[model samples]
Target: MLFKESFSMAFTALLANKMRSLLTMLGIIIGVGAVIAMVSVGMGVKSDVVNSISSLGSNMLIVSPGSTNRGGVRGAAGSRTNLKYDDAKAIKEKIKNIDFVSPSVSRSYQIVYGNQNWNSSVMGVTPEYMSIRSLEVSTGSFVSESDNNKRNRVAVIGSTVATNLFGTTNPVGQNIRVNNQPFKVIGVLESKGQSSMGQDQDDVVIVPLTTAMERLMAMDYVSSVNIQVSDANKMDQVQEDIEVLLRQRHKIIGGKEDDFNVRNMTSLMETMSQTTTMLTILLGSIAGISLVVGGIGIMNIMMVSVTERTREIGIRKALGATFQNIMMQFLIESVVIGVIGGIIGIGMGCGLSMLVGKFGNFTTVITPLPVLVSFSFSVGIGLFFGIYPARKAAKLDPIEALRYE
Candidate 1:
């Protein structure tokens, strides 16, 4: 059969030039390896982003007083003193969907335990902040309402903060000095990893907002406030309610922009997800160009084979071989190279992805859709690039091809 003849010819050609075949396949191997490695890295980054975002809390909202990159986020450094304790209380009491509210006050200073002092971030927050932010207390309790009222000199240390300040011993009831002010350790928080902005949440010490404002910082202005809605589905309604309440409380005139901005956690997470999806698509498309280049390499080599096998082509043509047979032969040779290379590339891709995941210490999802699509694209590349060369081989004149010197 024609198919048997073509396979026989292909086997003969491949065996006759073992080194050349391998050298040609090298391009495909490298291309596939790069694609897999880059994609795996992207997947790992996406996972990190999701975890970081979710750590902030799902039913939470952040109200910041600023614009630009600092807008709608915490840690606003130079914003006006627009937010207050009254606003937090109002949101908690008035907003039906809001379950909890916590005003944020933060500063960085040297904290001392015994003779050792280390500089770290310290935050002043209400009691409900522990629940809103899902902060767990490893020892003792978070700041109580009495502590807030009496301006109690008490602090809750993060796990890492505790380790740095008072290693191996219970920190509760022990006194640590912040900016030379003595505050008793009331609790140690469980470890929460980095935030979306790459800030380490574990390197912190928390105290009551009232105490921080009146005693430590000597200021009444809060940096931000975190609000948690009762239900995830009612997030937009809650956000709108908070906006209206804040604007009314601030007494802003009609049509003027709000001095404070409230941001929904669900919207923020969706935005991040959409941006990452676009990034993944762009990166994959760029990597696909390498597969096309590898396919071209196969086509170029097949053309040279056709040139060298002119006598064989002429003999087949004279012995009743049709143009379709010649075309099919060359087409099969090129496609075989692509198919074999693709299979090897897939194996190399998976192996290399695992290596990247291990060394990078991040998640790499080898999803089925990407692999299937990538393989199909590679095969298409082979077929499209092989057309011109295959046609040239098929159109040869029997007399002239047989008489070639």
Candidate 2:
């Protein structure tokens, strides 16, 4: 028979059982929908993580005192007080591919701005902290080199702090207490929204490291230092150099391990991406199982269809129809069922993906690749499931088929 005749016969057979075809399509529909929805959700999370980390800066590297341990039994090489102001200055002068450096001595204090009092974090950092952290000063000037040199008790407040304290009044050139020590207001930072850790980036205050260490915090040790590299390609070399220099500076001999650590934002991004990719693959595979089950349902229905048409087959063969025609006709019927179901599933998947994008509070974009992939896979499933039943019908004897009730 001609290919057109085969296809028409197959389509006609499927049309004879519209209800069964529709029910078989339902499984494929749900499977495809789940695949798109789950993958879109994973992609949304990954995009959020990448943008949030990138906001910290492109070539930003964090150097902390505890990082020297390299994830030993101590865990995470957490920051220690071994870092000092002189170490920060030395890193500034010594490291190659160096851009800007900020040594931070962080403290939490109960801040009183008029009648509104709140406990807030305060950081002792140099003016360079602004450039290293990509922080911007909105209302006033950032604390300058002269401010640090003179050990001036000047501070910069976040916008949240500004709203809480002075209302609409100009906070600059005013006095606020840091640990109840009077400090002149030098600058106010623009709102940074939040950090990757979900902490409010704008809920803190800033002051010259000198003033913080000497006056209010009253500590001799630095908690950690943030380092910005001039070249992204040179990060490894620079990290190695910083480790060697700090190790030597801290008076630790080689082979015994260093007392400090260096970190870059790239590693954090890699970790997040790896996790998301795995989740996407896992969800896709689980959704794929439903497609297999749907294919099995198609096969079961096709077998029953063959059995029901036994007398029809006997009459066709008695009329001199070849076994090849019989095989082709039933095979076409199975493919018809699969192809129609695939189209419906693709539509359902795309529609569901859009619904998720709209109401799920995440950006779930439907690309053409996944749609095509899913549809083609469904059609393949149809062919695979149709094979056994089509062969069984073709192998039936004309005598036995004619005798069927």
lDDT of 2 by residue, 1-405 (tens): 788988988777777778887897777777766776677666766777777887777787777776443664664322356878888889889887898988888888877766677678998888888887788889889989999889998889998888888889889988887778887887889998766456677888898888888888778988788888998888888888888888888888958776776887777788998997787778777887888898899889989988999988888888888888888888888777778878877777778778887887666756666667777778888888989998988888889999998
Model 2, CA-based lDDT = 0.81
Segments of candidate 1 deviating more than 4 angstroms: 2-11, 67-79, 318-324, 347-365
Backbone collisions counted per model? 0, 3
Per-candidate TM-scores read 0.87, 0.81
Q: What pairs collide in candidate 1?
A: none
Count backbone overlaps in model 1: 0
The lDDT values for all models are 0.82, 0.81
